[model samples]
Target: MPELPDVEQFRTFFHAHATGRTVRSVEADPTIVRNTDPAALDRALRGRRFEDPDRHGKWLIGWTDGPALLLHFGMTGDLVWSGEDPHRHRHDRLILAFEDGNELRYRNMRKLGGVWLAHDREEVAQVIGALGPDALSIGRSEFGERLARRRGGVKAALMDQTFVAGVGNILADEILWQARLHPRRRIETLDEAERATLYTVVRRVLREAVRSYDYVGRKRSWLTHVRGIPGGTCPRCGTSLQRATAAGRTTYFCPRCQAADPAVGSGP
Candidate 1:
């Protein structure tokens, strides 16, 4: 799943590579672009230039003088610089061909997310109205306050889009592991230092993850490296990392290093 870091990367890329470029043509798979009429989209945006790349959580918005192009990269969706092959890639759902012969293509294997047309940023807000303050933009004081008011486990609070935007299941685990907190640790049990640690680590982990480009280009860490693998052991404490479905998402944490959940098992 594309999170804040991933969408931020896309936003940066879109600004640098595609902004100010004139759209010559647009070809879209009708099945993928759900919100706007294909003909209407092309007519409204064909001659316009892409400008002002912005992101809110996992959503990326690139706009022109006219309608804004909102993108949500679902599980397998990606926006890549279109290569030579045009029709060869079946997943290339939405392709915006530029006047310069280059293209920016939106591809999705699962079709979970698609393109949305918004007249302005305010309209984009209406589309994603349920989202709370962006994860990267909120200050530490606000983050602490939000967590202090939450009744659920810290991981669940972090992963809630309505509470704090952009974090997903994988990121929730990574941030919790880095802060040395159990996935099921209640927010009320957090001390000032622990709260500080969570806030600091959340931004740090996300920045590093985006800087590393999806965490693939960087050295594998104890927390991020264990994601998606079954029965993976902790790289830090050498403990068997336990897994459970917490708040409906699969959660992973080190038993020895993060045994702070009072309701669950033995703790430090």
Candidate 2:
């Protein structure tokens, strides 16, 4: 699924190309639009100019002169910009044609996540009300407090959107690995110091991801460089990375680096 950083990039993309541009036409797939149908979306968005967009967690909110557009790029979804004679892929769920003849396409293959049209601010709140504080902006104290409330594995707690929005499987593993904490480590078992360390690590990792457009494979030191490859070794140590089901998602970590006991830890 698209996490916070990815969605942030999408927000930047949308703001650069679509903002302030009038929508010349609207083409939407009904099945890929939530909260409203295709005809309604067209009626609401046509002739409106897109304003600056905001991102909360993995959701993108696009404010127009009229209605609001909400987008969630599930597991395999992305926003694409095309020029003249664009080859419209079959998976292009939503297409917004601009007055300048440019196009912004919301493409998704699996169709797990979709677009939503909100007529008012109340409707927008209703859609995103369930999400917790965005991971990027949550305070350290609040972050620790929320994690302390989770009685499950630390990895699972991080992956729970209700606990702290925008973290998914890949980010959870990366954060935990960097913090030198095991994926199976119980949240309740972490001391204040450990929790503080975790808070710092989360902020650092997330910010690094947001700053770098090509973060995942750009650095050899990042675990994401070899997350799921065959015989992938730890970036810190030479130990072969291990994989298991944590938080119901495939997790990868270095056994030697991320010890269950903090006392035996490699410094984060």
Candidate 3:
């Protein structure tokens, strides 16, 4: 799934290419846009002009004259921009041709991504109502408060969109590992110092992610170096990195660094 940083990059791209451009045409292949009815989409967007694009959590909103078009890129979905041919890929769920000859395409391999037109602000609010404060926008005090209130594992809490929007499995593991907080530690067990450390770590990780374009720690960097290596030894401690399941998602953490509260450790 495209997380906050990836979506942010997409927003930048959309803002530059599609905003203020008149829609020349709207094309959709029913097989690719499984979540929306094609006729309704064409009727709503074909002749309208695309305004600014906005993002909340993992959802991308493209504003038109009336309603906003919402995009959720489910695992393998992405947007492409080209100046040449407008139509090429079978996976292109939605295509918008511009008057300037440039085109923006929404493509998805798995077809799990979705699109919806929100006729009013209330509809947009309802779609993202469950999301907590955006991880990047929330303050330290508010983040601490939310962290202190949850009793689940810190990793699971971070992964929960209702707890902190925009954090996914990879980010949850990276942030917890950087803070040296075990993934299985109960949230309420965190002291003031731990909470502060987690908050700082989250900010640092998110900033690094934004700067690097979602490729954080994917290279030789400390966090990225460890995360991409399966069955690899911990970078800080030599103990073998552990893999387990939490909240129905695969999680990775260093046992020596983020080992569970010695008093409450257990296998998944």
Candidate 4:
């Protein structure tokens, strides 16, 4: 799953390559773009100029003349840039040919990715209404206040989009491991120091992720390095990493570093 880091990387790429360009053409193959009708998408975007691109959580928003295009990269979706022919990838569901002869394509191997045309920019607010403050943008005080109110496990609270936007399975696990907090620890149980640590870890992890290219899992030093490596050792503690499902997604944690808290073991 593309987390906050990956989404931010894509946003930067889009802003550099596609923003402020006039759309010469729009193409969509129904088999690939699952959520959007081909004809309607084409009618809404063709010949319009791309205003700017923005991101919230994992959602990518590209503004046009009237409607805004929303892209949700379910699991395996990505954007590619090429000055040559654009139809090189069979998975390319949405293609925008610019007047400058450059092309930007959205490719998704899994059909789970969605493309929605929002008639108004405010529609984006409705689509991601559950999202809390952006992980990168939230202040330490605000994060602490939000964390103090939650009763769920620490991992669940971080993973909840409503609690903090842009934190996915990988980030949640990495942040918890870095903060030395067990995944199942109750949010209210965290002291002021622990809450501050959590906020710092979240910002640090996201900063490192954004610096990496495309937020792809290509770097060995990244948190993605420990995410699903079966029997992988902890990067900091040198102990074996453990895996389990928390909040319905696969989670990784350093058992030695973040021991299970008895007090919060039964939390939501």
Please report the candidate that would top TM-score against the real structure: 2
Model 1 Cα lDDT, one tens digit per residue, 1-268 = 5888888888987887789999998888877776787887888789999987889888888889888888888888877785544553778888888999888888889989888888877888888778978888788999988888888688878888889899988888888888888888788888888899999998888778877775732446647686656777887867788887787888888888887654455444
Worst 10 residues of 4 by lDDT: 259-268
Model 1 ranges with Cα > 4 A deviation: 83-88, 262-268
| 49 Cα displacement, candidate 4 (Å) | 0.6
Candidate order, lDDT descending: 2, 1, 3, 4
lDDT of each: 0.82, 0.90, 0.79, 0.79
Q: What is the C-alpha RMSD of each candidate to the true structure, in Å?
A: 2.3, 1.7, 3.2, 3.6
Q: How many pairs of residues collide in each model?
A: 0, 0, 1, 0
Stretches off by above 4 angstroms in model 2 are: 263-268
Ten-residue region with minimum lDDT total, candidate 2: 259-268
CA shift at 266, candidate 2, in angstroms?
5.7
> What is the Cα-based lDDT of residue 177 in candidate 2?
89
103-217: candidate 4 lDDT, tens digit per residue: 9988888878667778785776776567898888899889877877789788888878888888878778778877888887777777777888888999998887788664535
**lDDT by residue for model 3 (1-268), tens:** 4888888888898898889998777777676544357777777787788888998878888998877778888878788888644456877788877777778988888878667768778888886678898887889989977876788777889989899888888888888888888887788788778889999999988878878854755545455566647677777766788888876788777887786774554233
Deviation (Å) of 259 in candidate 4: 1.1
TM-score pick, better of 3 and 4? 3
Local error of candidate 2 at residue 249 (angstroms):
0.6
CA lDDT, candidate 2, residue 240: 96
**Better structure of 1 and 4 per TM-score:** 1
